[model samples]
Target: RSPSYLAAQGCWPGRRLQGSPALSPFLSKCGTFPPESCFFSLICSLGSFMVMLVGLLRYAHVIECCGPSLLNTLGLAAGWICAAGLTMVGNFQVDYAKVLHYIGAGVAFPTSMLFVFLQSVLTYRMAKTRGHYWTGHLRSILSALAFITLVFSGVFFVQESFVLQHVAALCEWIFIINVLVFYGTFTFEFGAISTDTFLVLLKASQAPKSYKSDSSTASTPHGHSHSEGLAMV
Candidate 1:
């Protein structure tokens, strides 16, 4: 039970639909709503964390490469960890959750994703003849500020109802839309990385090995060239 739930006294009996003309009409039995709401919070935390783990694992192929993918994975992994940490705070305390959330969702995740993009572009540019695009700082403070404003503003709406609720709902939707856009863009870039890496590894694994012979003839440089020519024939 989070601090807020504990603080709220686990659903005040008379307070079910209090102050709000909207939810009061549908009483919907008894104390089930509060428990259900708690369960939903748990699910959100678990789901977000699991999804973040999957994203990081996908980029784990570069463990030894010391390449752009390593940076891409690390930045994203940090973001997801921050997100998970915030969600955990939400499970235990509302204020703590909000504070952590503002940092994670608003500051960490988006900025981390921005780094992922920069690393990807840098690595990609390196592989390509035109390698100039890899030069900029992809994590922009302006973007982070916007996300922080949007995130905290939506979080501020959780307890709202009548008028305040509506405004909060609008902010919530705006935040969600922003996240969805980030999701789509990241998905595309991740796909490209996966496909490109797979193709490269596949080519390497399937390529013919250099010709070698067991006899002394194969040990000599001229013999190696002859073996190569013979293999081609």
Candidate 2:
């Protein structure tokens, strides 16, 4: 994601600017996805890098840091797909027509996410159940977005081919928003796991109020077992 690249694209002032996006220069926004998707790649890479760093500092942190894996993975993969599609389109280099590029952008981002979400819902279900249901719900929300964009794409495909050129811009804005939302969840989960670990350590490092506070002092075998189970859980 380079500013220079963006500057190059922006300087072009897409055909959509010529008339309404619906009746622009090119009909198919088909293009090769880039090596790097715009700023979105940088953000995704940075976020993943940070999570890896945190995992190194704490064990099991990666577990918390890694699932909803599908969405995160798809977000990253879609960036590449966009880059490829863009390349195939040439960003209007030979011909200043970008409807194909927009079409690709519109369909690729969310479609990839949908596949990713399906993977998450199916793959990460066990001890993760109560923990990650919301992840599935989020997937559903995005699935709805994908459906709408897909329908719009279909309309453009069949009726208004020119609109396909603009679909990428309008639809991809949602991709940006989706990235933000996913990051927010990632931050929350990281914080949750981190705080949970910190609290457990705080309790462990603190001296027991008195010798009787030790687990061995529990009145009955059942009491000691219950306390142990709580600690393990």
Candidate 3:
């Protein structure tokens, strides 16, 4: 819908100025207008929320399977930050909030790449079966493709030529689609999750602060008990 609006206004792939510089038809550009901007904001906000939820679930799943670790913690942070960037990108139109929009783009792109890479590493580290190994291989390929496309998109976007700008936009679309596909891959692991997984996460989160000293004293045994109860999916 936003694309159609942009196309109607000759802003889908904007034209070059006769004597001035031209701007590429970025997805953000689609939200520069009135009605389309409304829809853009709505969609972006929803997507951002969904991304945050997915990140949380993934973090919880990892904790349930392998217990919490720095890598998983970093992955969770990266995912949430990426979601925040997406929220900024969607709510602030590039034409109106240029600085903030670019900032959002900067945060969203790199953090998303980081998220995928960390997830790929986690997949390999956690793999115990033939299927798990194949999943890791698939994730590695997606991560590599994401990195390449992201690099190309950034490189091409800064060029002075209109053709290069278009190429940048194409690369940007590919990068986004690739990331979405990577997220979809989580369905395989998610399918294995059980009620106990959620129960463990709930108990961990709800545990009283008064038990901190006791928990610390018995951390090793408690951790092993948790690991035994929360079987890997």
- When 2 and 3 are scored with lDDT, the better candidate is 3
Ranked candidates, highest TM-score first: 3, 1, 2
Give each model a TM-score.
0.41, 0.37, 0.81
lDDT of 3: 0.86
Instruction: Give the lowest summed-lDDT range of ten residues in model 2.
Output: 23-32
Ranking by lDDT: 3, 1, 2
How does residue 184 of candidate 1 score in lDDT?
39
The model with the greatest lDDT is 3
lDDT of 1 at 122: 38
Residues 12-60 of candidate 3: C-alpha lDDT, one tens digit per residue: 4565334533445578875777798899889889988988888888888
lDDT tens string, model 1, 61-161? 34223333545556556557655654643354333344544454444345434544544443444443332232222223333444664665556556545
Question: What residue runs in model 1 are displaced by over 4 Å at the alpha carbon?
Answer: 1-35, 57-66, 69-74, 93-169, 192-233
Error of 2 at 177 (Å): 3.3
Residue 221 of model 3, lDDT score: 90
Clashes of each: 0, 21, 0
- In model 3, the runs with Cα more than 4 Å from the true position are 1-23, 206-233
Please, what are the lDDT tens digits per residue for candidate 2 over residues 46-159? 544543343332223333444334444444444455444434333432224456645644554454454445433433442266556766566557656655655554455455
Q: How close is candidate 2 to the true structure, as a TM-score?
A: 0.37
